[model samples]
Target: MSDTPCRVAVCWLLPELEQPARDLAARLQLPVATADSIEAELLLRLGGDGLSLQATGADAPGAVRVDFVEGALAHRRQFGGGAGQMVAKAVGLRGAVRPTVLDATAGLGRDAFVLASLGCEVTLIERQPIIAALLEDGLQRAREAGGEVAEIAERMTLIQGDAITFMAQWAAAAPQVIHLDPMFPHREKSALVKKEMRLFRPLAGDDLDAPALLAAAWALASHRVAVKRPRKAPSIDGPPPSAQLSGQSSRYDIYGKKKLG
Candidate 1:
């Protein structure tokens, strides 16, 4: 089916956020409202705190927002193994070589931000408009925060579009690593499924084209392609991965094209 999030509306909670809300409403062809309580399954809310995707209904999941300066991301940046985390090693982050990365399935940009915080220039492509908008807001806030957060945010560039076409037609400086975290069915009992994903599943729908995404990543990355999968999940339908780095809950399957310094 369509690979876009459904039932999205644009709204503003602050006067300063009104212009951007209206602008996004016009671009996305969605209704604009001052209150998020308006009739809509999902709301793209703009406020002084930044953009957040909120869901309605009594049992709705918690709101999804990107905040690089605090919360889980901050804790991970501080405590998670630097350049030694499974993802770091999977992307070929050796002593002197922190390869530039292109994250093709940047849903909320957590991994990409991690790579950036470690010194890799990262370009993110999020196909879903709602998620992309949230990422952009987070990046903007990070930039305004200054210091290391700003530096890290500066390393990230968000490009909202279909990554398959983007990789195929790319003519700019090609990234050394292409990362794929295509959506997979979240096992009900698995701790890997976050609340944000509860809302994301309904918006992003099923990821029926992950195989194609993997193929695109394979053809484009100069050094390697890394696919993040659940530890016990089956591999994508394609060439076998050259190597695998496993963590407690997730797996990184690396398809090497060439060696990175």
Candidate 2:
């Protein structure tokens, strides 16, 4: 990962978010400053649009933010097929039982949100402090928004720490399905990558410790472990998956320790 620190602060135009911004900065140990004041490689701005990241010298038109109440997340919640989507199938969501999921690598809480929308209780673990803060803020706003979105947000939990350590300590009380979506090295051109990917790649880097995470999942998950990877990327180094669910851009390698209901 780049040694450059990500400068984060609230957007000056939205003074109401300043307190929360300061709280976030304290939690992440990041310095708070105006967008133009810092000579940072990346600036994470918290405001009405939620938390967004912008490259200081990039020519991008807008910032990348995580908004669970609207945009892609809202669209997916409203229209996304429930318990029958590829992710649901990968998590073995069938019959009447909705497996409790431990999303070990909950980058933006996208997958975990999907699972929660499908009736599964999801615990999201994001090791990166900044990403976790963004996700937590989004969830908080989602809960206050009320209605179906709030209900789904209620089923999701967020934690900030290393997944391997968390799972190692919580193995005895582990959830039935443990989900892993470790970051992989993508070869796409910088400009061509999605804004979110472009912003997150520099912060989280590749998951060099994924194999260790997978092993810990195996030890903790009672029923199965699901690993999400690029469509053609090889599975994480460890025991082979028992089944596979393929999607257009990605695939789920399912390691079943026991039969699902």
Highest lDDT scorer: 1
RMSD of 1: 1.9
**For residue 252, what is the lDDT in candidate 2?**
97
Runs in model 2 lying further than 4 Å from the true structure = 1-11, 188-192
Q: Report residue 206 deviation for candidate 2 (angstroms).
A: 0.3
Count of backbone collisions in candidate 2: 0
The Cα local distance difference test for each model comes to 0.88, 0.83
| Model 2 per-residue lDDT tens digits across residues 163-206 | 99999999346799999998887765423367777677778878
Clashing residue pairs found in predicted model 1 = none
lDDT of 1 by residue, 1-261 (tens): 154446778888888778888998898778876543558888888877888988877888788899999999999999988998888999999898999999999999999999999999999999887788889889999999999999999999999988998999999988999999988875677664577877788777657888999998888889999999988888999999999988888899999999999
